[model samples]
Target chain A: MAKSKTHVSHRQYDDEESGWACMNWFEYMLVVVLASLLLLGALTLTLFWALYYAGGFAWTEEPARQFNLHPVLMVAGFITFSGFSLLLYRICRCCRRIYVKLFHTIFHALAIPCIVVGFIAVLDSHNLADPPIANFYSLHSWMGLVTMGLFALQFVVGFFSFLILLCCEGATAAFRASLVPIHASFGITTFMLAVATCLTGLTEKAFFKLSSKYSEMPEEGIIMNALAMVLVALGILLSYAVRREPFRTQVKTFVTERL
Target chain B: MAKSKTHVSHRQYDDEESGWACMNWFEYMLVVVLASLLLLGALTLTLFWALYYAGGFAWTEEPARQFNLHPVLMVAGFITFSGFSLLLYRICRCCRRIYVKLFHTIFHALAIPCIVVGFIAVLDSHNLADPPIANFYSLHSWMGLVTMGLFALQFVVGFFSFLILLCCEGATAAFRASLVPIHASFGITTFMLAVATCLTGLTEKAFFKLSSKYSEMPEEGIIMNALAMVLVALGILLSYAVRREPFRTQVKTFVTERL
Candidate 1:
């Protein structure tokens, strides 16, 4: 009977008060961290597309044109992600959102291991490898793919869900004011643009493999390159070109007000 | 006895636990937010600098270059700062030290706003000003100077302090291992590079004022423009070349370890 009473009290605490596993603040922060991480991840992937897949990747060739590009983009991308994760911690630091804290702790810890492994794979592929091929593709590629995929899905889906719920019920004023569509659009666009670019990357990597085998850029290689360029160009335009007059104002206003 | 015991207990809590203001996680976040806001406030000064010290001023002449450029760069700069802010936040998210969070928040937040404002001013002045400037000392030019000055100070003073503490702890194995020199070098070089480039901006604005009054390039305008190009070329080299090696290593090591 004593045990039952203690368990009941604890259960009530979990349900009605902040606990380690469930709370509003925790959940909200979890979403923020996830969103930022997703952006960082997308940035990294986009860079990889630019450096390795976009025609400049000679890891083994003396003066490998294939792999020389701006190192800051990738470096800054990770740093940005790390910063966002910190923001998440701060957001929950003030509140007692046990569930978010738990989520934050578990996911970040798990993410650390993944990030470490991915980084090692990248280092090995770049510095240690003899080079024509960095042996970077197998697990390194897929591990990154999965990690990025998880972040992308979590951020987009979470935001979309929150937005829909807000619209359906007319979310509280504080909550309503917080919804930012431009930021969200930037988030989602960065992710989707990354994916579209990645597809082009796969095609380019194959072309590199084929061209290396033949010792020449084949007819198909040239065609694929042009196709890839077009896709990336379109993506860049979409990402940056929205800054013009009337449309920019409408989009910004809607996004700020709605979110 | 009861009153004395209660007084002692309250004192103990004060010592052991952070109060709402000084050292709690929430307060730490508040400091960071406060710093970020300060950085934003600092940007307003940039605008005033241009107005007081710059050369030509005619927003009506270049609507697209004027207002469009302002907000576009503002948005871009903000995005950039936010991205880095997120990374910094992630790094120390779990840190419990009072001084660590306090100083870290202060420096990182303060540094970026200056950079963002300067960047926007420079970019806007060059591209958005519509009609090419006959001088380099306009409202925009002065704003750029302020931004540059604040950025330099923030990087050298606040950044070094933040990094000193960081290196002392040697927390992340990788952070301690190789990031030190690269981190420190960028701290100095970015500033020097900015100084070299920003002067030409002032010259350009000055020419604009003279051009507006006299309707022609001053004798010095031609020389100043040439110097501007040279400075710009050097700045590019500094950014892309000198910064690249450390940045590359940092990027690789960072991505490899932290992801």
Candidate 2:
């Protein structure tokens, strides 16, 4: 009876694995394709909103127009670049683990300048205004601060632990393996925080700029709202992609590569 | 050689399990206490904001004051009750699975009235206003609608699959088991959406009611911002607790219970 029970359990495991395998290809492709589209679409919509509705962007020449760079660049940095970086893990499951890690790091590194300039554009816009707007006073600014801080921390920790520690690979293997989940969790949290901050920022902008017109649902209002919805949709899709166990790469290389 | 390799891997597993067991109690207690406090603290702060700052609540008699009920009750329903319900799975790991499920269902059921009344309070406040404010126009309102829709869908699906299908436990066991992760993932997503909705709503309110005073960081603005921080902290802590593998229960009963 005990032998039969063991056999039954082993078969059950096989059945579950096979079930996951069958659905894996289509679902994987769907998530990758949809996520790619939404990431790029969010950036495109923001650019459109900034250019078409909110005058174009400028540096110190026009602070009002300079403020427009804040949203567009933030969406590009936080949503587009950071998002693709996070998705690289699942998207490049067939690639060498080192190649995937390099791409992830590269993508995030590319986001750094965009975020820094985006931060500066807003501050410059506010300070350069005739009657300077108060900086970091609103909830949106506060949330953005938190998100940026988290992003910086994740980048530093990931760089040190995942890449730098690889020099002493044998000794640090277990440590790196343990940090993977922690790094991944915080990465996703940072992304979600960015999404929330953007939404609040958009709300503030709509109310501040559109004023009573926001309630009237002007073209700009609808466009901004659509942009917000895309962010929301991206939040849902990315989280689902990251959390679903069946989508996780099951390659033996994953264990050997320890990433 | 084969037997030795198998023994080595088995011992590694044992070591990992034992390591988790050592840290489990302290970490578990910390998460439970912290989560409980934040969950209640959020609701309390919102009450203070509504009552002290926003002039408290009323029904249709006083439309403006009645709007106060919307934030307070929404926090109670969406953040407090729904939060505790989600945490019960991890918190009551030693309890019978059936009891935990019953409690989860009961807590969510209690939230139903709070949400419904909260929804109506805002609607009445808008419609009964002297100027008759528009409904579902702002990004906040749109986000709220999405949240409420998701909440309702989750309730129906959870009730039907987890509770009603118990009548044929043997035949439906595999089906129910598969639904567990999906249900769990969506539950967390719904909670996060609720948090995002609340943050956007708070931003809208601060801008709409507080107006220019909000930037000066008045007492009410500080209070509302504090409340937002608490919600953000809860989001981080709850997600960590749920996702941490070491914190997950590993009892033999877990498999037998299939929760």
Candidate 3:
């Protein structure tokens, strides 16, 4: 691929310079928007697949639901995220720095399987009645242990990295400007999941009942899993908002320092 | 505090780098090692807790065991995993690359409650007949859905990352050299969970009878559940083994490339 002057970040894509619109800006934006939607849609289908499986079990009156996290693990898992990482790799060539792309690529790859296997061994065979094969009490035992174990590592990494930005590296001004948007984006994602996980637990017992009464349920809680999801969405939004304010200042500093 | 000529990776240390011997290479290693052991030990406890709950319910004098995944989830999920996540922070300094650490962190955090609340919602209040609300069946139904959902995300992330490495990067030597270790680690983890999830599902109907002396039981299946546990262990061993060959090559590479 020829090196293009176009620059696109996670939040926005630049016009004209991006080659995305060298021919036509409107067409380019539409394509980018559609690509984003396509990515999200692919993800949503996986969720629907599980629901479909459950419905198949309940409605079909057979144990047809004994499917492992199959379709995703072998086929989807192998395809989707790995594919995206490549997309990111392409995006990275135009990135301000190699480190950002490298980090993001590595993260997307590692995070997925930790999640896949962790879910399989701990959560795959579970239900509210049996608890996990290990916990079986409050729905909070071994799965929690494993999940948190991995997350714990993430937190430390984040804290230190954040520290580096604040003190060691970013305090130098050049580093500070380049790092904020992504830093916030990742932070927002983290916060989103954190809040989602918490509220998801809170509402789990209520969801089935809530799902049954969806027609009569309050608009606020229309979906069984709505509340937790909302919080997650909010967290992601706030993360963006919080970080957006600093971008101009950051970029200016970055360019000036470079000059 | 001064910038120095010597540098060390997060996982390595030098004796002269620090003042206190107790604070140096061996001690630091020991601290991290001990901490890891504690984390693992807590995991063991969490697993046993779930087992205890579910087993209690079925093994009870009543028609079924007294406990299930709920107890383990609540006791271990809510409490233990969080506590251990904190411990892991101390051990590894948790910072490596964002990929490994954050992947670890996010998984542990989201997974715990997802398992716990998922279990609680499915298991908390139930009668013990047919579908057996508080038993393993319903638990498996609901918990399976949630666990599978999370794994789907993981698989997509991992599979696509691998694809991206292979594709958008143009199969360049640089891409191959840097990503192969990560790709290998993630692949091994994926395979481990794949086998484990499949076996768990396949053996679901026969778990309780794994080791039973029932003359009528199949020869290779004294009790599928007993065998499930064995498979879990073996699956884990294979998980570790998946890395051995690749890791050895990486070690050689590390020596040749960096060390």
Best by lDDT: 2
Model 3 residue A150 lDDT?
39
lDDT of 1 by residue, B134-159 (tens): 22322223334443554556456544
lDDT of each: 0.39, 0.86, 0.37
Q: What DockQ was computed for model 2?
A: 0.63
Error of model 3, residue B72, in angstroms: 6.4
- State how far residue B132 of model 1 sits from its true place (Å): 14
Docking class of 1: incorrect
Q: Count the backbone clashes (under 3 Å) in each candidate.
A: 42, 0, 85
| DockQ-based class of model 2 | medium
Ten-residue segment with the worst summed lDDT in candidate 3 chain A? A56-65
Writing each residue's lDDT as its tens digit, candidate 3 over A99-213 gives 5444544655564674566345334444322322323222223223333443445445544453344456545554444344334333323332333233323243233334433
| Model number with the top TM-score | 2
lDDT of 2 by residue, B218-246 (tens): 98889989999999998888877777666
Candidate achieving higher lDDT, 1 or 2: 2
Could you give candidate 2's per-residue lDDT for residues A121-238 as a string of tens digits? 9999999999998887788888999899999999999999988999998899888887877787788888888999999999999999999988899988998899888888898899
Question: Estimated TM-score per prediction?
Answer: 0.26, 0.92, 0.32
